[model samples]
Target: MFTRIGRFVVRRPWLVVVAWLIAAVALTALSPKLESTTDQTEFLPSHYESVQVSDLEKRAFPGQEDQPAAIAVFQRADGGAFTDADKADIQKVATGLQAKHYAHLTKIQADPAAVSPDGKIGLAQIYADNKDLSDTTVTENVKQLRVDVKELLSGTSLKIGTTGPAASALDAQESGDNTDAMIMMATLLLIVVLLGIIFRSPLIALMPVVLITLVYLTANGLIATAAKVFGLDADPSSSTMLIVVLFGVGTDYLLFLLFRYREFLRAGMEPRPAMAEAVARVGETIASAAGAVVVAFLALTLSTMGMLRSMGPSLAISVAVSAIAGVTLVPAVFALLGRGAFWPSKAWKREPKNALAQRIGAMTARRPGLVAIVSGGLLVALALGALGFKADFDMGGSQPKNLESVQAMDDLQKGFSAGKAQPTQVFLENTGGGKLAQDQLAAFRDKIAGVAGVAQVSPAQPSADGTVAQYSVSLAYNPMEDKALDLVDGALRDQAHAAAPDGTRALVGGTTAVLADIRTAVERDYSVVFPVAGLAIMIILGLLLRSVVAPWFLMISVGLGFAGTLGATVWLFQGVKGANGVLFSLPVLVYLFVVAIGTDYNILMVARLREEIRDGNDPREAIKHAVARSAPTMGAAAVILAGTFGVLMLADNSMLQQMGFAVAFGILLTAFVMALFLVPATTTLLGRRAWWPGLKEQAPNPAGEEPVLVGSGRTSG
Candidate 1:
């Protein structure tokens, strides 16, 4: 099948090249203008308590504006109350915001309670004009409001500072931008230096940078299209990840193809034929490796977190696009470049001693069972960590501490209840035509306070029309903690609703409620996303390998890799690190990166195995031959890829560390164990029957083509 494909591509190389160029141009042009949301509330279903509460607020207070996403907090240097002149200046700033018609900003309140304690600080509650505060227009309004506030406060005794959702978001954006720039520059330098060292050719080193840029543009366009067609949500973090995956993983794929291409060229094949045969021989492996990664990313759909679920499709789409580019775009471009692709370096025409890979390969070939047992046993032991896995959904905690929002949260936690930063609100609304008495509301608050897990209940704040009253309920644990989420969504909410007056309705909202909703969204995503991704991967595998049997077990092996990675993470973070729990989204991320990228090695190994078998070698010979030839490429690629992810451990955040460990470790395990030991051993045991439906045939070698096995063995491929 691959031989036929090679012939077809070689015969009409121009056609393949043109098709990719045209597709790249068209897709790049038609790519949608995508926007990502970091708004935690947006991911929740409207039926969830937080969403319902939000909806009820809008309905009950039809003309009321939501709170401004940001606020300019003004304070006197002397810690004194604002003078009438200071008040007037603030009012002028507020009046300008009103003139601008900021979405969700109805009016600004210069009320005294809006001020902080010690009479030094004061706040203007900038009520917005619309419900959706994340709109671009709203962002612009906030920007203008800042300008106006600065102008109004000019030369005044008060010092103004903005600190709220918008301000914090802007700060985060700046930090992320800085991080992105630094990471990109660092990654670029790393890849160039590493590749340059490896190939000893500037042209060869620069190829990945150029190729991956096109891959990035193409993948992004396709991902945007997929998101538009399927209604997938992307987060702010997606761009950083996309860049890394495209360059990092794309480089790995390119290395895989190049290594094989170089080997073929050294064997005396001319440039064009060597390139063609290279793609033909390694194409299935590249496709399969990509398929495994795609499947693993798609498995993120099975995550019970909206962030993970949404991230699943976004990343899967990127991988799929990269995979397509790997086979079609990469091969076509290389085909056009021919031997000159290695300009100034005739190293491709020579062979390396490669004593290390050869020795390891010889050992594995000699003692396949022992190799398999030791490697497989190590993964099994690490898998035990998964039993202690716990989930933490603390979004606020993930935010950097330098931000005012985070600092304010800490201050609020210290001064008041920890829940003051984000309290759980229980709302009781009038269900009957008649309004309930104040006593009924008080009684409901009492009942809610007495419920299990409640720390305290603040005095009820009545709605403008008095049809609804909101009571803030504090909990003993972080709102994102499983126990707190369970408390809010389980007994507390249920009990509050049950005990509500017949004429009144009840709903829970705020941080805990939002968390509960997020959990539900994640659960729904897990059910929908994982299956689609897996099916897509299987289809790609089946197409590449032309065998139904091969794709299934490959996926199963990758799945085990995922489990082992997660379990290892649990042990490291939960047991060793002494943390509350691993991030709720960690498992999904590990599954996506590890399973997907890990599969690349498997695909490379398996495809080589098949190629060996197709050349009329028995399964045992194929396994030995495949491992000997492919192990070096796989090891090199895995080291580079794993090293990239390993840098995430340098991050200050625990979440990034967990991700770094899981993905890096998983890649090593996948390459060393699953791909090298398990796959080869299983195939060796299966022998000729493994390639069922495509029986082994001792066909004559093509004219002028000498059979080349990895170390002079009668291996497959």
Candidate 2:
């Protein structure tokens, strides 16, 4: 199948190249912009308490629902306590801003009663005309409100800055946009520099950059089109992640073909046939590696979390597109470039000495059991840190501390209750669908207020129908902290549910409740999604290797790498750095990338090992040569891919920094430890049994794939 594809592409390279160009351009022009939401409730299932509260509020209250779109925090110019006159200035500013009746500005609430105890901070809550923060009108209103507030405060003794849902959303979106640009530029530079260092040819370095850029455009357009057609909403971080996946994975596939293509060239074959033959030989390997990634990602569709469910299919689409291009478009481009792909460097004509790889090969060959034990043991020791891993669900903490919202919120906390910014709300719906008296509302509020973590509970405001009541319950701690998680998920929920009046059932819903639910959902995903992904990946490895035992051990190695990576991160963040916790989703991301995407390195290495064994070398000899040959490819690819993600560490956001470190460190472990050391050593120890039922070690070598000489650049043939 691959041979036919190679020949066809080689015969009409121009046709292949032009088709890809058209696809990228046409899709880019026609597709609507891909959009995402940051609203936590939007991602929850209807059954979750938070989602239910939202639904009930929207349905029962209709036009009455109004939350702050932005909070205008006012203070004296020198940061002194606000005098009575200054409070009047704050009220005047709010009243004047309200009179302008800006678009999407619902109402500006400012009160002397809302002043902080320290008297240094004053607050004004700006309601929006819309609900969804994704709506640009909300963001625009935030911008306009800031301008209006500035104008209203002109020449006054006080200064005001806006912070809240709309303003924070605007700032976060801008940060993401800038970070995405930085990630792209950094990834491109990283790939080019690494590829140049590895191949010693500027063309080889620049070729994958240009080719993958085109493929990225095509895939991105397809993802947007598919998402729009299907009505799917993806996670906000999907675009930045897709950038790394396409370039890192795409370049790895290209390198696989380039290495083999150059081998055939050194063996004295014509450039076109050599390119075709190279495609024929390694195409299955590339397909299987990509297939593993695609399946693991697709497994995310099983996730109950909407973020994972939507993100899964989008990433899978990207991987599928990259794999297709790897087999077709990449070969065609090289077919045109031919021997000149490595121009200005005659290294392609002879074997280059890779001393480090050779030494690793010799060490594994001399002591397979030792290498396997030591490498496996190191990973296991590192994996112990997983026991201390803590999950943080705070969106505010993940932002740069310097962000206006974060800074303003911190200032507010100094003079008010930490959780005052967004308090937990509990709703009581009359199950009998009857009116609720003031007594029942008071009794329910008292019950919630009795909870240990409950600092304050506002009076219950009954709906017009009188069948529901809303109470704002502020906690003694920050809404995003672990104390908040336990309090909301445990004590508050328990109290509310247990103490409801006979005709009323209570539902706890707020930022903290939503956070606790997200934690529960992710925990459930661990049991469901992780197992499903593992099983799916094992099936792919089993089918690709035609070996039952190999898949099990290979998966074991990858799993260890996942744990090791997490443990290392936990040690760094939680232990040494004294962080409250790593980002909540770090484990999920690590498992998906390290256990799934990292499998690519293992697949490449093991396939090479199997090839050496099929070429009639002893298992130990095969392990030696395979490590020597595959190490350079996997190492180069790993460094480049890891660097691409590591670029995220440069981001100001802690979420991006944690994600970047996890993936980058995991990739290094996957390549250097599992693929380079453990897998080959263990395979040598297992010998022919690794192939088991297929047991093709002594089988005849296929005609097109002659046993290439391992020691030298040229083939034995």
Candidate 3:
């Protein structure tokens, strides 16, 4: 099957290339705009309490839908108490901003009652006509608000800063834009330089970049089209993630085929036939490795959160596109290039010494048990850090510190309640369809105020028809903190429900409530996604190796690698850096990338080991030979992919930096420690038993060695 595909693609390179171009262009033209959703409510199912509250609020309090989108924090420029003139300037700034008629901002007002008791600070609330922060108009309004406010307050002693949902959304979008550019440029540069260094050919270095970029556009178009057609929830992070995955995954698969092509080239085969043979030989392994990645990602369909569920299809699409391009487009391009793929780099025509890889292989072969114990022990030691891992739900905490939204929040907190900017709302509904008495509403408000974290509760404002009453509750803690989440999730929610008057039901709704529910959803997803992805990946390995036994230990090694990676990240971000918690999605990201994609190396090495054994060499000789032959390829690929992600450390956002570290370190660990040391060592020790029922190969020669097939020990770089 793979041979036929190879011949077809190699024989008709132009047809293959033309088809990709046409598909990419047409799909891109037809694709709809993919809106980035930061709203947590959109990620939840309607069955959750938080989602239900949001729905009820919209229905019962339609007039209140257009709330303040941002808060303009004002203070005297010299850090003194605001004089009457400064107060007048603050009001002037608000009125001027409002008069501009920004796209989403409907009104901007400075209320006399909003000034601090010490007269050191004042507040001007900015109201938006719509609530969707992801809407482009919201960003434009926020940008213009900043500009207008600065110009409006020029000669006065007043200074202003903006903080609120709309401002944060604008900042997040800018941060994402900046980080996306750096990641793309850095990833491309890393791939080009590393591939150039490894293969000594500019042609070979740039080929994967060219092919993957086309695949990226095609995959992106398909993802957007799928979301539009199926109404899938597309999160803000998915697009940025897609770019990184395509380049990293595509480059790995490209190396797999290129090394095989080089092997055939050295065997004196013609360029086109050699290219076909490379695809024929390595195609199944590439496909199976990609299958593991795809299934692991698709398993996210089981996630309860729409964020993960929708992200599943988008990422899975990119990997599938990359796999197809690996076997088809890649081979097609290389077939046309022929020996010119290597260009001036005649090193492709010579066998590498591979001395270091040989020494490492020999050491493993000589003492398989010790090698296994040492490598396995290191991973276990690091795995201990996983116990200390803490999940942070405060999404705002990870944004760049220099962002205007963050700085504004700091200023606002000095004179106002930390949670004043966005307080939780308690909605008491008359489920029996009767009006609630004022005294009963007051009693419920008192009950909510008695909760430990509730600092204040406003008077109940009954809806026009009086079927629902809303009370705003301000917490002592920041709304984004875990303390707030705990307060809202546990005592506050339970107390609200239990304390409601007869014929009434109380529902808590706000940022902390949404985050608490997300925590529950994420916990549920872990139980579902990990087991399903693991089982699915194990099945793929079993099929690829034709050995059930190999799959078991392979998965065990992958699990250990996952734990170690998590542990190391916990130590770095949580322990050493004193972060209150790591990003909630870190574990899922590590598992999908490290456990699923990292298996590519294990598959490559073990497959080579199986091949060497089938050639009638001793088991130890095969381990040594396999390790020696596969190491350079694995090392080069790992370095390139790891470096691609490590560049995220340059980002100002804490989440991006942490994400970059975890994946980069995990890939290096999988390649250098697990694949190179543990896997080969364990296979050496397992000997023919590793193949189990499929072990029909010639038994190891106990008395002496027999020379294997021609060129069995030669190395290709």
Candidate 4:
């Protein structure tokens, strides 16, 4: 299959190149603009309580203000309590803000009751016409609101800061934009520098950047088109992730092909025939590795959250497109360039000794048992750290501490209940289709307020028709905190549901409620997605290796690598740094990259070992030669892939930092420990049994005779 593809591509390289160019241009021109939502509620299924509450609120309170609201908190410049004059000035400022008529801002409401008990802070509610907290219009209005408030208080002795869903969303959006730019520039620089160092050729370094850019554009367009067709909501982080995966994995595939092409050149094969042979030999490995990644990513479709479901397909599409390019566009370009692809670098004509890889292969081949034991023990030691792992669902906690929204939140906590900025709401609706009596509202509010962790409960506000009543309940803990999520998910919800008026149904809704539901959904995904992904990847490995036995140990090694990566992350963040918890999504992200991409190294090494075996080398000799040959490519690819993710450490977001470290470290482990030593050692120990039912009937001729390549009729000596 790969030989035919190589021959076809080599025969009409221009045709293949032109076809890709046209597809890229056409797909990009016609695809919809990919959009993302940061609204957690939107990702949840309607069956969840928070989502149900939201639906009920929309129906029961048709005239209710669904807009996102922020509180502009004002304090004295001198740290003094608010006096009558200061209070008057605050009201005046509020009135001024209302007069400014900011776009997307619906209203500004000021109240004497909003003053803190210490009399040092006053608050005014600013409402936006947009209900979507992540809406760009809401962010724009909040930005303008801050500027207008600053101007309104310019001459006064008061300072103001905003905190709430809208303000936080705006700050996060701005921070994300800055972070995205940094990540892209850093990733590109890293790829160029690293590739230059590895190959010592400007053309080789630049080729991947240029080719991957084309792949990135095309992949994103196709993903956007698919999302538009299927109504998938792409996550805001998808674009950033796409850049990393396309460059990291795309470069890995290119390196696989280029390194083999160089080897064939050293073997005295002509440039064109060498590239063709390289494609024939390495194409199946690239396709198989990419298939594993695509299948693993597609497993996210089974996720309960719409965000994961959308992300699954988006990333899968990216890897699929990248795979196609690796076999088609990439090969075609290199075929056209011929030996000039190496440019001034004459190193391709002579094979280097690669002393380090040779030494590793010699050691592992001689002492397979000791090698396996040491590597296995190291992974076991690291895995223990995962025992302490905890998940933090607080998205706000990931933001930089210096941001205005974060500062405002700190100030708000000083004067008000921690949950004051975003209170939980419990809506009680009349299920009997009649007006609910006002008398029953008090009992419901009292019950919710009486729950542990409850700070205060606002008086119930009934809709005009009296069919529904809404109560704003504040918790003593921050809405994003685990205690708050627990109260909302368990006690508060239980008590509210049980204490509702006889004819009404009570539902809880708020950020905390949404997070609680998200936690449930994520926990469910762990059970479903991981097993499905694992099984799918194992099948791919089995088919690729032509042995069920090799796939089992291969998957186990990858699983160990995954555990070790998670444990290392927990040690760095939770134990050493004393963080409360890692990001809630860290496990899934770790599994996706560490297990899926990490498997690439495993597959590459094992495939090379099989090739050596087919060359009539004994198990020990095969392990040594395969490691000596494949390790350089594995090391280079792993470092580049790991470095790409390591750039994420430069991000201010904790989620990005954790993900960066976890995947980067995992790749290094997969390359240096599992693929380089443990896998080869284990295979040597297993010998013919490793191939089991699918063992080759006869080894290829040891003489320099052309041997058939997998999935291809063509042969290469």
lDDT on C-alpha atoms for all candidate structures: 0.71, 0.86, 0.87, 0.88
Q: Which stretches of candidate 2 lie over 4 Å from their true place?
A: 697-717
Mark the 10 consecutive residues where model 4 has the least summed lDDT.
708-717
Clashes of each: 22, 0, 0, 1
- Enumerate residue pairs that collide in model 3: none
How far is each candidate from the true structure, as Cα RMSD in Å?
A: 4.9, 2.4, 3.7, 2.6
Measured with C-alpha atoms, the lDDT of residue 414 in candidate 4 is 91
| Better candidate number, 1 or 3, judged by TM-score | 3
TM for every model, in the order presented, reads 0.83, 0.96, 0.96, 0.97
Query: How much is 481 displaced in model 1, in angstroms?
Result: 3.9
Can you write out model 1's per-residue Cα lDDT over 1-717, one digit (the tens) per residue?
A: 455555556567789767866777788899887777875666665566788888787766676656546555665656477687776666666665567665545676665454444444555655556555555566556666667766666677776655555555655666567666665776677788888878888877787788777767777788888888888777877776776777779888888878877877677666556666676667677666776676767676565555665776777677777766666667667777777778778776666766765666566666777876776677777788888887778755666677654654453343334554356878889976466688898899889989877878988877777888878787866676788899988998898889899878899987688888787676566566656666777777677666777777777777778778888888887888787888776765676677667778877887777777777666666666777788878887887788767766655456766777788899998998888787777666566655665554556657876433324233123
Better of 1 and 4 by TM-score: 4
Cα TM-score of candidate 1: 0.83
Tens-place lDDT digits, model 3, residues 1-717: 687788799889999999999999998898998866788898898988889888998898786746768999998888899888888788788788878987678788889888877888899988887767656788788887788777788888888889888898889898899989988998899999999999999988888888899999899999999889988888888877788889998999999899888887887778888887678778998999999999999999888877788889999999999999999999999888999999898999998899999999999999999999999999999999999989987888899889999988988888877888888988999999989888999888888999887878999988888999998888888998889988999999999999998888999988888988999999988898999999999999888888989999999999999999999999999999999989898898899989988898899888888878877778899888889889988998898878877888888889888888999899999999999999999988998899886755744433553322124334222
